[model samples]
Target: MNPFRTQRPARRGGRLLALAAATVAALAPALTAGQAAAAGPAPVPALDVTSYLGTWNQLAAVPAPFNLECARDTQANYTLDPQGNVAVFNRCTTWDGGSNEIRGTARIIDQVSKAQLRVEFPNVPFQEDPAGTPNYIVTALGPDYSWAVVTDPSRLSGFVLSRTPALDDASWDQVRGAIEAAGQSPCVYLTSPTTGGIDTIAPLCTR
Candidate 1:
């Protein structure tokens, strides 16, 4: 009956569509922030490779199938080879009181920070690609080279290493923060066995 009556429905539909668009626009920043957070934080800018050399005890790690054989007392020893590659020696006590050791090679992939490395072990097929993943990133380090935190880009693997078998509560807290900053939940990591020392057997450490 009114001239604007016919236009009412069309105007209502237009208003609904405008509201929807405004809602999406309002959520755009939040959605983008969530995506960025999910992408994870970047790796540390620099690493002192010389001070990082020597022995490190595995204080904690995200469980991986490759390391399932290790029951406790997990440790890694790194030394520079003549050709500038890093000699990697990893050892852990098995469930049957025996020891398991693996020797590998680590090549520095990032020359600037030397924090990124590609590790390869002959006969061990962990990665499908022969070139390996350049995900081994050193995310954090202790003030005196007493502890370090390593993680990959996927956040699937992480390791807390210490110069000694045990770390102070403050250091552990720092490690937890670092792990979280790397976009990983610290609760996902299992405390590695170090009660029996670096190479000793302790079945309880497995839990």
Candidate 2:
């Protein structure tokens, strides 16, 4: 045998090392994902609440019992209220070819980011969100407030909003990307069938 040649014990040690390396390689992805989860999703920096207040089209949203009547053509119009809160007017087409709407108020909770707010709808029989949970977090937004990804602290309910009823391919991709960045699966967001640009009511991931 050569002077530097290893015996059976050395071969065993080498095999163990190789096995450990393979194990780590297999777990690397999971570890990285865990790190991201630990960090948690956050809102964009210094959002201009004034510029953000306007009409936003509902591109896609997580299915919620409160929105069961909304078959298609969803939109939200926001304006400033004298009490320093935002007034919310959400409208959507019902299956019976009539329009339904609900009015609410959004009070900004996080003064710094200006992306966290609490919305309260008065006299609405539908109540999906838990009581006293005061966060309607805007997790993602585009430049000039072209598009937005809305989610709550729990990351369960979500909404993909746009400035118009329809969006281009790049804008659609950006919306989906924001959803993924917020640690939400696009499959949970079903597209809202508007006038154009992916009018089919299907899961966002299918498109």
Candidate 3:
């Protein structure tokens, strides 16, 4: 069953209303909230993966409920881990003020193009089961492939990844424009909180 459809009736007040709205919204085919009225930025049709293979810093992103438990400095790294699979290194600060880290593998499930691919964590065998929808789309990539945006077709997911935590304001704007073109409402992006972590990241997320 779709997780969005499983709603409890006990909740009341604003929470219930918001859940109802989310369920209705999820069932619809339109892009997630904030996609309409976007203009100017032209959509880039394909991504370049060859140059895309490298470490990318997570700048700002929509806070998905699944990742909510992650610390403000949460970041993911991709490398050709041993065993010939795309290894994923996910690290974050824990709520109890500890470090959170997990290792997983990724593969190109759809093989749409050399540029586009779906990445899955927890390894391939675990993903083969029916309960697997935690996939991400490689939407837009920089010319040098130093930065990229990952979002699903439903527009329910968005991530701004870079080769470094700090990106120039002008280049960031260009990426934001491209995201808008991909039908994502730019208003949902929230800056990653970076304070007293391994990497002191300045809040680079913007509207």
lDDT of 2 by residue, 9-88 (tens): 33433443354344435545654565457555688777798999889988888765466566577888899999989999
In terms of TM-score, which candidate is stronger, 1 or 3?
Answer: 1
Task: Please report, in order, the local distance difference test score of every candidate based on alpha carbons.
Answer: 0.67, 0.71, 0.54
Which scores higher on TM-score, 2 or 3? 2
Winning model by TM-score? 2
User: Candidate 1 residues 20-61, lDDT tens each?
Assistant: 345435545654565466874466688777888899989877
Encode model 3's per-residue lDDT on 168-203: one tens digit a residue.
Answer: 768788778767667765555545545432242222
Show model 3 residue runs off by greater than 4 Å.
1-48, 81-84, 110-112, 123-134, 195-207
The TM-scores of all predictions, comma-separated, are 0.74, 0.77, 0.65
Name the top lDDT candidate: 2
Error of model 1, residue 116, in angstroms: 0.6
Model 1, C-alpha of 111: deviation from truth (Å): 1.1
Candidate 1: the clashing residue pairs are none
Q: Which stretches of candidate 2 lie over 4 Å from their true place?
A: 1-40, 125-133
Ranking by TM-score: 2, 1, 3
Model 3 worst lDDT window (10 residues): 1-10
lDDT of 2: 0.71
> What is the lDDT for 92 in model 3?
62
